[model samples]
Target: MPVVESTTRRTGGSTPHRAPGRATRPRRRQTSGLPWLLSLPALLLLAGILGYPLVRMVELSFQNMRLRELISGRPAPWVGLDNYTKVLSDTDFWAVVWRTVAFTVVAVIFTVVVGLGIALLMRRVARGVRLFMIVAMMFVWAMPQLVAAQAFRWITDSDFGVVNYVIDKLPGVDYQNHSWFVNPWQGWSVITTLVVWAGIPFIAITLNAGLTQVPKELVEAATVDGASPWQTLRSITLPILKPLLIIVTTLSVIWDFGLFTQNWVLRDGHPEPQYQTLATYSYTQAFGQSRYSLGSAISVITVLLMLGVMAFYIRQMFKIGEVD
Candidate 1:
């Protein structure tokens, strides 16, 4: 019998054949540079708007930019690290730093805890009650910081203030014409209360939104498994909400660490040393004391501190992304 050659042709004489599905599988397209190109204009605009001032501030921090130089339209003489040295050496500055750190810690803690509680409450409340709470919170959030600070100031006024009036009405309390700011602790308490009250709306609303994303089936499973409410929250809810908590807490720390409007306005635009935070301290140094360079240094330091917080936030976000 004659052997006939096979009619089929081999594409690759030695290569193994690939399965149809594997052969047809599409590769993921590389991410395009169009997105970066499209965003260039906004990035440039922000650089001009925000970056210039920041650079100038740093420049000023290295100089002796007194009122005289500001008025003379002449460049301030460079002073190298003298401004930083002066600021770092001042005992009062250290006191202000400690005070600012303490206030931030207290304010952030209260804000996050209270905000979380309100968020949980919102989840459990009747629809109408929840709506009312949301509306009230919206109003508070919409109100300007200046207005809120003024309102709090009026509320805690030494004379003709409602807080004193209500306290004095108690059976044996003598809070009439009480001065809240006379004591630093009391003043800080008031400031903290204002900060927490103002902050809760944002945190509560955001967390409540996150709560909606929680799987109802998982929650039900936990309940069916005889998990107490606290246990469920501790085990399930908190772990899920960890990302949101970190975000809000970091933002609260940044805002409260730079406590300015509330402290300045409450103290009538002249916060005493006892009540001074980094922001107020910077302003007091620059405008209040005409130490522009020193104030710039303080501001630069404050920015550095905020950057540290932001870095931690970014790191936490990366961690969450990795976990997901």
Candidate 2:
């Protein structure tokens, strides 16, 4: 007992022993500074890529910079708001804006509606069929914008096109050698069709992912309560998926607004001036006519217009969310 008591006295009782050279660790103080420091590189990269061009565009918009001034050693003269005033006063520009809006609205509506339908159908399909559909959709979505436009052009060509041949086959219908691009409206229709076809795959895939997250138990409860399919969808499915739908629709609106490649390719050499969108118009002013400042102004205005549209959609989404 004396030996045990002597040993206990020499050693610390129930306390952790530290190494000879060890010291107590200090507590970490939480601050937002670390996160900001970590994000600094990403911020700089984004500024270099996006911010630089935007600043340059704004600066160019205010200056009288044409191809001639760029070619010569002369400095670009300040034009102030002349470019903006000219664009705003042009009736043709306003016409293009309205046409672009119409096309975008129609295309978004068609894309969302068709996509929702496809997503819903996918839920009921066999696993093998679903895989095949998904693969096919990916292929369509992967198709290059220019390639799709060119394919559509070939399909709708005035001479020896499949579309004309199909129309001619219908009784009392003669569409042989019919030119789809003969008028502005017809040309715009083809463009809209191409946009809708190309856009549907993405929306469908996104919605399908959203649909998978929906509660099957809730759906079963609705079915057990004798609710019709449409009733269940409107009262349950859509409400649950509102956030996703809003996001998809907003993206569609933005994409359709700045739709350039397909439209340009489809109407390569012969887009009617009245039917031209902001993108085509800006391209004409910039590359086609060498009026750099005017083009920059138009491009700036286009961005402002799109921002306004996005703001409206965001406001509406918030309102709906609050109501729910």
Model 1 Cα RMSD, 1 decimal? 5.4
Enumerate residue pairs that collide in model 1.
none
lDDT of 1 by residue, 36-118 (tens): 99999999999999999999999999999989989999989999999999988999989999999998898899889989999
Cα-based lDDT for every prediction: 0.91, 0.89
Where in model 1 is the C-alpha error above 4 Å? 1-16, 19-28, 318-324
lDDT of 1 at 221: 100
Report backbone clashes per prediction.
0, 0
TM-score of 2: 0.85
Model 2 Cα shift for residue 278 (angstroms): 0.7
lDDT tens readout by residue for model 2, 1-324 = 687667777885644568999898899976778899999999999999999999999999999998889999698999899999999999988988998899899999999999999999999999899889999999999999999999998898889689899989999998988988777778788888999999999999999999998999999999999999999999998998888898889989999999888778877655668557889889888888999999999999999988877897888778878876
- Model 2: how far residue 265 lies from native, Å: 0.9
